[model samples]
Target: MTDRFSQASGTSAVGGVERRSTRSWSGVAWPTLGVGAILALVPLWLGDSRVMMGIAVLGLAFAAYTIAFNLIFGSTGQLFLCVGALAGIGGYGGAILADVVGLPIVVSIALSTSAAALAGGLLSWVAVRRSLGVIFTGIVTLIFALTFENLLLGLGELTGGESGFLMEAGRGTFLRSQIPPYYLMLGMVLLTLFVYGSLRRSRFGWAFRALRDDEVAAELAGIDVARYRIFAATIGAAILGLAGALLAFTEGRVSPTTFGFAEVDVVVLVMLAFGGIGSFLGPILGALTFTVIDELLVEVGQLRVFIYGALVIALFLWLPRGVVPALDDLLRRRRAGS
Candidate 1:
């Protein structure tokens, strides 16, 4: 893990440096890419396709989910709360189109992704028209999320209602073979990281940050706050939408339970909080740490739930910005003291 961090990132706090390094993109991305390359082969190394598949699917899906979440909530400071709903739109839309409408799986997923992006874009446009503030935006989106879930439940015949959507074995590309799904996941995650890294260093990212810091000041500086927010929402929602589509394959079905308030969105949000929101690799690290922690605690039964909750509280109390930021601060302080 240490080596992966060192090699993938050229950012440094050692030698009295207190900020990210001015490394080229390749240098900045090497560590993450290296780790991903190794992850790609874990199925062979672990000798248990099932175990490896579990790791890859869950980790990659949530990593993608959190990446989108980080872009809106963390980077741009838009409290866009309809993440799971948008993902569900993609998941259910894709599955129903594929299973019922008999569209090709790829086409279904593409349309579903587009639908999710359209939903996000519409929400952004509405929010801008209403001149909604952060809290109002969150409220409106949360309402949309709740409404979406109910919409699925209302369409009981189509969605399978309380029983959930049932996917037969060997249904989707993600289930064709464990290896294929894992590779797909690995590819998506790496691509997301690369895209995010590039975007973070681009003009869009700068505008996003400027909006995050001070909207009024950004507006004065000629930043079109409304336009960029919409861009973030559309792109981020599109990413989440794709993840949702992949998720249908991951679980072999679609369900409201899979994309509800206490499920997908909250999990991704917790991951972002634990990993240091807005930092490129923070949520990934957090996802890894918590997923392992959850797996380890499974044997402890219900006690693990309490433990997990306690840990989150502890994190907020002592390390509010998350593990990575705390470590960065510690390193900077030590260097200053020295």
Candidate 2:
């Protein structure tokens, strides 16, 4: 009777936590969708300027990247430093499959996405097997990123070297059009948000939080830490792959610069940091804010990277928890006072 009662109580407690998580996510879901709706209307103002529209598309891409990073790092504590490399794998892989192999773009995207997921899963498996902590995982992934960049530079004949590979695959299609590409990327952003939110409301979210809060405790509580972390990494990597593949198609080229670590990974980390690491709307907010900042600093030229480096240090030092969570705390304080 005692064992049965204890088991029943534990089940109820777990159920209560899930219910609370669902409610918490539900409160934020509509606002997230509203933000997406607002972004969808951006073509209304910038439709005439191709340059602005291009910047907007790039912003959405970065937003998607941050979201993927958030899922891997924030949810499960896997610090993957090769965000750009995994993305480059998809971008370069898709372009090669379409242009060189003469496969349909859709087929190429699927294959490249699958390849990225497998690669991500393998990386996660290796990390788990080695019992690597966050810093070690980042170090290993950073090495992978460096190797990928060198590979692009070395394989001049195949990858077009630093000149970039012109994607004849998406040429003359709607992807080349100015407006359609914006909506296409917007769709991806919204889809990614939905997926993230859904995971946060499901059993996966519970497991993620458990492991994130304390891996040893989670393990004691019967949570499979390795499996959940790898699953999160795989899912996040698939999103990154899909986003990268689409970016290649829309941009009509793939270059080392396009998916370089300094370009994609650093910028994404800054965005994720500024917006809030674990907050639902944090990545979008950070991406949007930094995208505009980046465009504004375009005239500064070479100095822009220096400025970003400074911002990364400052933001991490002062706003470690990020703007979204900070603001959320302030709001709660005000409500309590009222």
Candidate 3:
């Protein structure tokens, strides 16, 4: 009896060690290091300051927005279509607060983000109460977006209407300069990545995943399904608001045209789809790839959108799991063979 017990214990200990070693080797840290190294080398290879800076700023903004989308679509299994509209609300709100209310840019941003988050939370509450599916959610958000655009157009005095608000004294400083914006965006991206990483390791993340897999089962397992869903939406919206604020500051202006349905739909869907939607890196990969492609094809003018649409459709048809998952699978297979 003693010998049998000792043998079992010994096997368990050895298995545990092996498992830990394997996980340590195939960890996020190594992947993160590789990504960082690549980013650091980008400036050295890309001599065009304007292009590089534009890419960095746009990438960072889109990354934030995509991450926010992941919190709802990827994590909570909720499909939200108003992400762009919420961001526009944040942007316009910040601009108004700064320009009209005489608030500082930073304070205006904070206030604007908070307002958007609150609105998002309210929307989430409505969705959760009704148990709205993806289709309904999309419809609701689309209506909200159209309403916002029309409101902006009708209220020309406050929003500067169709002409848009121009930043006079606010423009041309280092705060508005390319390098400063790039560095600021980089810092924000790092912060967002850390926040998302930590969240995924938390109890909330587990609950969210469970809810995503089977909401009824998760509820039976003691998870508050509605609560988790609402929390996800609220958190996602807050991140979106922050991204919007950053974009507004970067552009030195806020305009209704910026939050149009077409742009919003293409960006949000492309980012989530191109990214694997399985891991934190998925959205990052999607955002970076989309931005690079868009920049490269911008010279093609009107043909660019058609090309992008075709590429996206092709990707969906050929690689449904997306670029990241396919590449990761290939890498894993190669490693296994080696």
Candidate 4:
């Protein structure tokens, strides 16, 4: 009877923690959701389809991707450098399934996402399961990224290779414009945020936090470091892959240039560095800020790259952990002073 009672109490305590987490997330979510709603309406005021589609919609997609990256590197403390490549795998896989194999869009996306998840799990097993150090693990993933790029290029007939290929736009349209995809991307961003918050509150999250802080201690605590590392990697990759499938549908094309290592991998890392990793607002803020900056600098052509590089350096110098954490610290200080 005592053992049973103890188990019941433990379960209830876990339940209470979950409830508190939900409440905490709800407190933070309201402001973020309100801001997002306002941004969603901005497209109507601006009345520019290019701006709406290019910056707003694509930024939403990239935010999802960035969140995925942050989870693996920031939360789990495992640096898997194949973010865009997994996304591309999902993109190309779904495109082929939907466009070529005549599968339904839903089925195509599901299958592709599953494929990405499997790949992520396999990557974790191959790279980190043997207890490889962090730097070597990154190198292995980077090699996978390079290999994936080559595979896509080599499979010209399927993935359009260097020349690129257009997707059949038979579905995913709304009101004869890009609005539907925009909303779709927005929905995805919200979903990713929701999952991120839930994870942040769960025992899984605590495990990640512990693992990130000290693997040996986490293992001693019975956290199963290898299992959770794979969990984080697989979950993040699945989110990224799903975003890629959505992007393939949105952009209506698959190409090598779209998923280049330097093009996406570096850009995402820089965005995370700018946004503050391991925080909920970091990925969204970073992706949106960079996308807008990119749009503004569009007319400047080559100068934009130089400016971006300079800005990143400056941002690091000014706010080492990115904007959100710095802002959070400022708010805390102000409150304490008051």
Candidate 5:
């Protein structure tokens, strides 16, 4: 009787814990659903197709790039600046493979993404061999960006050099216009968010965080720091490559001018820093805010970049942890109060 009672009590406790977990998730879900509903209604309310499509496309692309950046920098604590170059490679490679080799867009995109992953792995291997800090990583990646740009510029036959190539309109009946592209981008963003969330909750995520926190200690704990770091870089690069391919398809063109190196790194860094580099939601928030600000300041001409730079500086000085962290803290406090 005692043993039976003990087992019953344990089962009851387990059930209670699960119920609490469900409630906690519901708390998060309701707010998310409410916000999503409001956003979804905006296009209908405004009835401006162009504005809606433009916002959707730009926001989605920015989010994709930011997520790729976060995979390495936020999770693995590695600073990299080659994302734009790799993305450009993916875009050009996909376009050429699809146009010249007669491969399907999907197949070409896969090939390009795979190539980018391999390149990223190789670069990570080289980077691991040296004890370069974040600044050094930025410098090395900047050199790579320059090299890639110059190489593409010289390869007039393949890349079309400065003139660029105009791809055939639409791949199939499914992806025809701005609306379709917007939906596709939304799907990719959701998929990436799911993948990232799962990854953060997995054992590999723990290993990554361990390495990020302290490489020496992680190594002592029998964690393969170098391998994990390389893995992060490779995966991050693949995402960037895929994002690039998507951008190419959306724009229906590939060009050297699209992947300029000068301010790419700064934009990425600012987004990551402003959104809170420690959380999954940081990149999304940062990307959306930055893209909106950028679009709003488009009319400012040359002064736009200066304004962005000032805002970044102000963010750093005032809220070093970024917006998401601050919001998260507030939420936690509210929950505690409730």
Candidate 6:
């Protein structure tokens, strides 16, 4: 892990001073663009099938969520389990603002995203201030997730409760279209990748790697652990919120199931685990792989969650750090042998 971080961070000692290598940044940028370009070609093949295209858009949204979650859990050691809840805030908040309050869609999305970000930041602050461990942090966040769901149900008049809330803001726009929304979601995924890659090559990434490796050591080395964790959570939550809001507008509805904990959080966690935590392409790969798997598992009906649980157990037992990091290690070893 230490060696991997050192290499990815591109640090070199010269005359007792640490310098970053531009090679790493270039390496990251090209691959990111290549991946984006490849994904951009999906619509060419699937354009005719409305159902498939819709599913693809949803897959892209999950990819976006994985990226945001990767930034929070993969970057820092923060074990936040409220991924769905935070996104629910964005989706529901945007729906209420745009449909009920008569606010513009853009304004509603912005405000909702901001609210999610603030909520995430506050959650992180509480965790840090209380010196919560990973398990305790997860527990707290899980509780918050449940609470958010109950809150939505309790305020049925506003949120539309179990029946869900129908949104009319982007009804007549391109958001309701199959192709355009797919591209919009794809663009969001690409933009998130760019931002994530940029961060990985910056000082922030260095700090994140440091803290993740060892919080006490990172603090001793002069990194502000609390501030950086909060920043990551806030930024990730903002992305989650924005994605959720856009999805709500695109679907023209907001429902508890859309951002339910079991629906979003569990899936995202599995995706991140499969992708390799903290690896640049991990989230995208995981989301793509699992999206296909999930689609196939639709036939199983109630057994899907059971399969997911089994997969999680299997992954943690055999490939705990995920596919990308394991493959990276294998390649490095093979090169050394050569």
Per-candidate RMSD vs. true structure?
Answer: 5.3, 6.4, 8.2, 7.3, 9.0, 4.2
Per-residue alpha-carbon lDDT of candidate 2 for residues 124-221, written as tens digits (9 for 90 to 100):
99999999988899999999999999999999998999987898997899999999999999989988988887787688877887777668888999
- In candidate 2, how many clashes are counted? 0
lDDT, candidates in the order shown? 0.75, 0.84, 0.72, 0.75, 0.70, 0.83
- TM-score of every candidate: 0.87, 0.91, 0.86, 0.88, 0.84, 0.91
lDDT of 1 by residue, 221-276 (tens): 99998898888888888988988887787668788988887677767767777877
Worst 10 residues of 3 by lDDT: 1-10
Query: lDDT: which candidate is best?
Result: 2
- List model 5 lDDT by residue over 173-260, tens digit each: 4554646666676666656655665565456667766766667788899998888879888988887788778878877887886666
Q: Name model 3 segments beyond 4 Å from true.
A: 1-48
Q: Which runs in model 6 stand beyond 4 Å of their true positions?
A: 1-25, 328-338
Order of quality (lDDT) = 2, 6, 4, 1, 3, 5
For residue 129, give model 5's deviation from the true position in Å.
2.7
Q: What is candidate 4's lDDT per residue for 1-338, written digit by digit as tens?
A: 11111111111211113324444667446645864697678568654665456557668878988989888887776678898899988888888999999898889999998899889888887766677667887999999999999998898888778876888844546512556667778878887877876787667777876776677888998988888888888999999889988888777787876677877887788788777766666777888888888788889999987987887787666655676656656776788799
User: Which one wins by lDDT: 4 or 6?
Assistant: 6
204: Cα error in model 2, Å: 1.0
lDDT of 6 by residue, 1-338 (tens): 23333222222110001244533656566767888888889989999998888888888889989989989987887788999999888889999999899998889999999999999999999999998977898999999999999998888989888878778788889989879998888888888888887887679888888887777899999999999999999999999998898888888888889999999999999998888777678788899989999999999999998999999998777877676656666776788799
Which regions of candidate 1 deviate over 4 angstroms? 1-24, 45-52, 168-174, 331-338
In candidate 4, stretches whose alpha carbon ends up further than 4 angstroms from where it belongs are 1-25, 28-32, 169-172, 315-318
Give the backbone clash total of model 1.
3
Candidate 5: where are CA atoms >4 Å away? 1-48, 169-173, 331-338
